[model samples]
Target: MTPRPRKQVLLRLDPAVYDALARWAGEELRSANAQIEFLLRRALGEAGRLPGAAGPLPRRGRPPKNPGGDTPADE
Candidate 1:
């Protein structure tokens, strides 16, 4: 499956706000950018403003191969 594209945004925050966000993000074990996205999703969900179903989470790493796997004749 093709990967979805992410929109790049330029957000300007006050230094104090940025510092607070960085601290919070570290506490949550997420990058500052990821933390922002997480908070936005939560707020949107709480406000009943989320669009569409969350959908299946993207698979991690390589796709699993068939259990009855094929081996190359050379092997």
Candidate 2:
């Protein structure tokens, strides 16, 4: 038998807060859950806490060139 998918947990918030979240979610064309997830990701990304998150890194010279030798440096 296949394992069942994990269940999602629901959070209860103050009515006013929930209403605000709902309105923000509607404005962004996302469900409350999706809006929360997006907010969490953005927060983590800003804090450099997300796994495999892209941020500024030390420059390692120019990026690799494509297979063709048509790169500007080749000119």
Candidate that would win on lDDT: 1
- The true-versus-predicted C-alpha distance at residue 29 of model 2, in Å, is 0.7
Instruction: Please write out the lDDT profile of model 2 over residues 21-65, one tens digit for every residue.
Output: 999989977777777777877898899897783433222335557
**Model 1 misplaced stretches (Cα beyond 4 Å):** 53-75
User: Where in model 2 is the C-alpha error above 4 Å?
Assistant: 1-7, 53-75
| TM-scores, all models, native as reference | 0.68, 0.56
Q: Against the true structure, candidate 1 has what lDDT?
A: 0.75
> How high is the CA lDDT of each candidate model?
0.75, 0.70
- Model 1: per-residue Cα lDDT over 35-72, one tens digit each: 78878888888999977756433343456564345764
Worst 10 residues of 1 by lDDT: 53-62
